[model samples]
Target: MLDLLLAAEEGAHAEPTAFFLEPYQWVSVAMVVLIAVFIWKKVPGMITGGLDSKIAAIRAQLDEAKALRAEAEALRNEYQAKIAGAEQDAQAMMDNARREADAILVKAEADSSAMVERRKKMAEDKIAAAEREAIADVRATAVMAATKASRKLIAEKHDAGADKALADEVIAGL
Candidate 1:
């Protein structure tokens, strides 16, 4: 080993005797270096272009989602306003209904009072009619008794029509 090292150091070695002295190995290593350099330059641009396309696609999707969300919020606000307006209208309708019901009740009460008063007046009229009927009956009885007494007196007197007329004329002259 020492002798070989000395000979190697004397610069008398024209060729290397190691196992890795094949000429094809250098060409293969150079080819590998050239391919690596080519890949390093070209592959980065392809990768960046692919990543930029992906970022653009994602941004487009995000914009679409934002627009849809804004539309949904606007629709929700419109529905809320409609619901509020409907509730106000319903309250007004209920208030009007209550007022109408109160008016109907008042009118019914007034009509009932009027009917009661009319019934009382009719009862008083019936009583007055009954009193008039009794007075007429009494007068008819008095007229019938007077007619019977006058017929009895005329029969007891036994006077003829001519004699009665003569007596009535003399009494008138006196």
Candidate 2:
């Protein structure tokens, strides 16, 4: 086995001896020079710095997005509070309106009742006045009828003999 390995190593060295004279060897040397030039110019470092700057920009964008989201959430909360306050104010206004309506209704009812009472009182006063006028007219008619009847009776019953006797009696008394 040791002799076989030695024979393989000798064959490898022999192949390389002719490789130096081949076109492939020139290509290999050119590749090595190119690699050395790239290292001297620090191309790998520039690529790494560019990639790091991109990562930093992406991180800054993410931070800005988070800040904007927080501000939007705060604004939403403030609007919700304002909406709640507006609802409360509206409810209070409705309550005040209801109370005012009730008060107005009560006042209107009282005014209507007072007006009805006044109308009733005026009607009663008119009726009393009419009754008093009727009574006065009846009394005046009775007095006039009695006066006429008495004058008729005196005219029929009185005579000149009675009148002379009444005059002589009145003279004796005097």
Candidate 3:
């Protein structure tokens, strides 16, 4: 060792050696051995298989989520259709009620008019009956007065000769 160091100090060039190889060459050899050991143990295959399983699990979860979303959308559409139908039904009911109210009002008006006409006719009939009764009473009073006047005139003019004359005139006329 001392001789080798002296030779190096004398400007004599010598290649560095370890285990019959240079240091850089030994590092390359160590790397090759480490790669060979990894291959023997199948570490690469284990890593790839684990990654493939994780990818399959994630895809299954995504499919489940998509199915759930589709189901929820269908339910929402069904409820919306039912709400629209209910609104239409309510509108129809309101229209029917309005028509019924109009019909009832028209009937009531007709009935009231008819009743008024009947009451007017009854009042006219009562007035006509009263006028006829008054005429009959006037005729009865005039007939009684005429009978009294004729009786007085006959008594004043009457004698035995006029009585015989009146009997002969009545016989001749018959």
Candidate 4:
């Protein structure tokens, strides 16, 4: 066992073998070959190109979103303007209605006043006609009474002697 231990120690201190025949040297060579293959294939440039294309697509999407937002804002403003115009039109219509109502009211008032005046004039004319008729009736009654009184007086005072005198005078004149 002592001799076996001495032989193992001697092997451990021995000089290195040929570079290609060592296991660690073979692993180093494989890594170098793989790195060289990757460089030759331009893998880094392809990766950068792919990343740049993705960035451009994202930027284009962002720009489209901004344009859509601007279009929406413009539409909102247009709708607001239309609403304002509609409100103004409604107010104008209301004003016109009020003016028309006032005009109608004035016309109705005038018509009513005219009707009242016409009725008053008609009443006055009727009253005047009635007064004239009453006056004429009173004058006729007064004339009848005076004629009757004068006839009664003449009948009571006239005598046969005066009648004879009146008769003689009338005959002489004739």
Candidate 5:
């Protein structure tokens, strides 16, 4: 120690020292002591454990988000199916309405045609009846005329004596 002091006195350019150690060497010794103390306290294990816990929490959150996304997608697919079914039902209803309308039109046409046929039949029957009535009237008028002409001819051709002879012949036959 005395020698080191003498050396320091002899040169102003001597390296500075304290307690037989240089300043740089003391700094190195302090760093080694700090590292040893950290190991003894298990600070490295605590830091790694904290990091591991944080990683596990993040993984759990990711899994939950994935589940939620899958559920949302399923709901979307279900809604899409429902919409498609609704569209199909609407189309079916429209088709049914069109078919019913067509049926109604056909029925109406058939009914109208039947009505026209009935009317035609009734008109023909009326015309036939009128013709028969006119023929009957003409025959009656001809019979009346023929009877008058026959009476005139009989009066002109036969006298009172011929009528008395005809009457006497009818009485004898009876």
Candidate 6:
């Protein structure tokens, strides 16, 4: 380190650093100047202005995104509240439905029982009418049989004299 320092000090006493930048060395500086000139001449002010506007637009877009995020968060909270209320309403509706179903079931059972009783009464009436008809038919048949037997005993188709004598005896006995 000390040797490099001593060598640099000795070289400084030889000549100036700017003077060492001779004409050939100045070519590199001229190229740097040409690049600066190209930037100044070729690049339009409108392009730079448009770039600045684009940067501003990007910043504005970021601000808008932040606002949209806040809005989305608010909407999420509102919808969540609505969902909770709807859930409560749904539970109430389910309970109401169950109660209504139970009432309907009880009513249906009562109506069915009444209908069954009416049907039983109708059947009993029919059975009683059939029994009465059967009894009447049996009485008519008994009377017919008794009348046929009595007619057979009182008749004498071929013996008119005998029938007349029996009829006189029956009348005298009476």
Expressed as tens digits, the lDDT of each residue in 1-119 for candidate 1 is 56568878996754444465556777788899998987988977888999999999999999999999999999999999999999999999999999999999999998999999999
Residue runs of model 4 more than 4 Å from their true location after superposition: 1-27, 89-174
lDDT of 4 by residue, 46-125 (tens): 99999999999999999999999999999999999999999999999999999999999999998998999999999999
Candidate that would win on TM-score: 5
At residue 168, candidate 1 shows an lDDT of: 95
- Model 6, position 70: C-alpha lDDT score: 100
Error of 5 at 76 (Å): 1.7
Clashing pairs in 6: none
Best by lDDT: 5
Q: Write the per-residue lDDT of candidate 6 for residues 39-72, one digit (tens) a residue.
A: 8886667688899999999999999999999999
| Clash total of candidate 6 | 0
Better of 3 and 6 by lDDT: 3
Per-residue CA lDDT of model 2 for 1-174, tens digit only, reads: 465578797884423435436668778888999999999999999999999999999999999999999999999999999999999999999999999999999999989999999999999999999999999999999999999999999889999988999999999999
Using Cα atoms with residue i matched to residue i, what is each candidate's TM-score against the true structure? 0.35, 0.40, 0.42, 0.38, 0.45, 0.40
Better of 3 and 4 by lDDT: 3
Candidate achieving higher lDDT, 4 or 6: 4
True lDDT of residue 34, candidate 3: 95
- lDDT scores of the candidates, listed in order: 0.89, 0.91, 0.93, 0.91, 0.96, 0.89
- Which lDDT value does model 3 have at 129? 90
User: Over the stretch 1-174, how does candidate 5's per-residue lDDT look in tens digits?
Assistant: 677678888884566678889898999999999999999999999999999999999999999999999999999999999999999999999999999999999999989999999999999999999999999999999999999999999989999999999999999999
Q: Which segments of candidate 5 are over 4 A away from where they belong?
A: 1-11, 89-174
